[model samples]
Target: MGGFTLDDILATRKPRDSWWTVFMVDPLACRLALLVANHTSITPNALTRLSMLIGFASAAAFTEGMLVAGAVLFYLSFTVDCMDGKIARLKGTGTPFGLWLDYVGDRVRVVCCAFGWGFGEYTRTGDTDVVLAAVGVVVLDLFRYINGPQLKRVKDATRALLETRLEGQYVLAESVLRSRPRSELEQAAAEFEQTAEDTGATVVDLQKAFHARFPWYDRFRVFLVRHRVRTHVVSGIEFHAAVFVVAPLFGAAALVPVAAVAGTLLLTFEMFLVYRVWLASRQVPRTAAEREKILV
Candidate 1:
């Protein structure tokens, strides 16, 4: 029986997953676990399941009006959420299925938590923030679902370009290192350096070219290009969540306006991101064809 070590799982490069890493309390725990287990066994999926359970408990606490307990539990849930990927990395068991599971699990947690908050509010004060939050959650999920594949494609393209550049540089470096004649080697080394410099220049030039062609949409594209889990709009969503949490406790009618502003900002940002993504997708074919000849 082959057991998985933590190091193996952590080897997967997931740029999108890095945002959750910030929420973690003990970043090195997974690495430590890998050391103790001798790289032999443990699955990231298990940790993912555990995180989901903890997240559900946190949502339940919030629904039951245990604000302090709920906050603690939610933070714990977020921490576990960070650990699951780390555990996967340590165990070397990071499969596509596991990745898919983690993605779906995140959406489920968000949706369930939103619903729980809504239900809690409805029971307590017959307020509608909970319902609005639920709608917002659905909207967020819809945005993700619509853009997920396109984003993944873009990520893959970026990775390919980076890897190709690295490989080219490596080959050039090796040629310089294994020279039969010193003078020729020096010349080759200089050429290699020039090639590297040119490659970098080309990348910047291409970016500039892309911007020139799509000047109006370039800034919008840049803003929407979130490789990590860090979301610009989620900040607004979190603010709305805070409003919902505080309004009942304070009996403040002013929160309604605050909620409205936050919600509008979040939706506006989301819409802008979606539209930019659509525009970028439309531009991809032309960009791809131009790059193909250059790359070849």
Candidate 2:
């Protein structure tokens, strides 16, 4: 369990993760994590620093219009970024400062790569749209990193409020869906509703509206979860890969359009979650004074 083997290192991964990581990144990262953990006494923060340097090198590659080389370097940079996490989990050397370093490194890499490809392609063709694509990519990344965590916070606060008012543990739809299998999710939702009917438990399903309209969605969710993918298939991770790796393979003209498509897909699914969270929050029972305060 000291990360002497690839599987030992891989056991450190989150229960569910980005599908790209589960499929593409983890395969290479686990082995690398094992190698580094066994040989080097490198701290996670040190690995984070190395990752940022590789990411900057990727940006340099992109600036030179070495499209394939840039793509490869970008992937390698992300591989190192992921490896740091696994190595930390394996060695139990994780720290809050390391988390901060990792987060900052990721944002910086995104910014560098965005402008890297934008200016690189702009130089090649003198098309200003590529620059716009870079701006859009950064905007999307900002919205995700900022709003996503805040949404989770709001959901947690709502759950706290409900459990306080109702005097029983409440099962939230969003939490259950994200963490459980389809059958277990349905059972949990049903049990929550039944408990609410019989006692003081409050039921708030972020998924209620969506599931009612599209009953077949659990099947899709099952398929995605089986692959360690989530309902939001085109997350920021995929957006970055699509922009930096997949689109560039087709050359500069494809870069801007692919970025646009990737950004659109990311926002659409994110908006769906935001709306559902809002809807679910409304179902939380509030005292008249609390409702008045909200209105004020």
Best by lDDT: 2
- For model 2, residues 1-296, the per-residue Cα lDDT tens digits are 24287668868987777888889898888888888999889989898999899889888988899888888888999999998888888888889899899999999999999899889888888989999999999999999889889889877766666766656556666555564555576677777677577564444565666677777877888787767776777788888899988887888778888999999999998998788678777767688775454433
lDDT of 1: 0.53
Give me the candidate number with maximum TM-score. 2
Model 2 CA lDDT for position 159? 68
Candidate 2 regions exceeding 4 Å error are 1-3, 173-206, 291-296
Per-residue lDDT over 1-296 for candidate 1, one digit per residue giving the tens place of the 0 to 100 score = 33545545355334433233433433454454445345435577776787689778867875776655655665566566666666565445667798887877777776666566557656887878656755675565556465657666764454455445444333322234332233244566566668777554222122333345556643343333343344343453254344444333443343345446655665676665555444444432345654584334
Q: How many Å off is the CA of 154 in candidate 2?
A: 1.9
- After superposing candidate 1 on the true structure, give the runs of residues whose Cα lies further than 4 Å from its correct spot: 1-20, 23-42, 153-206, 209-296
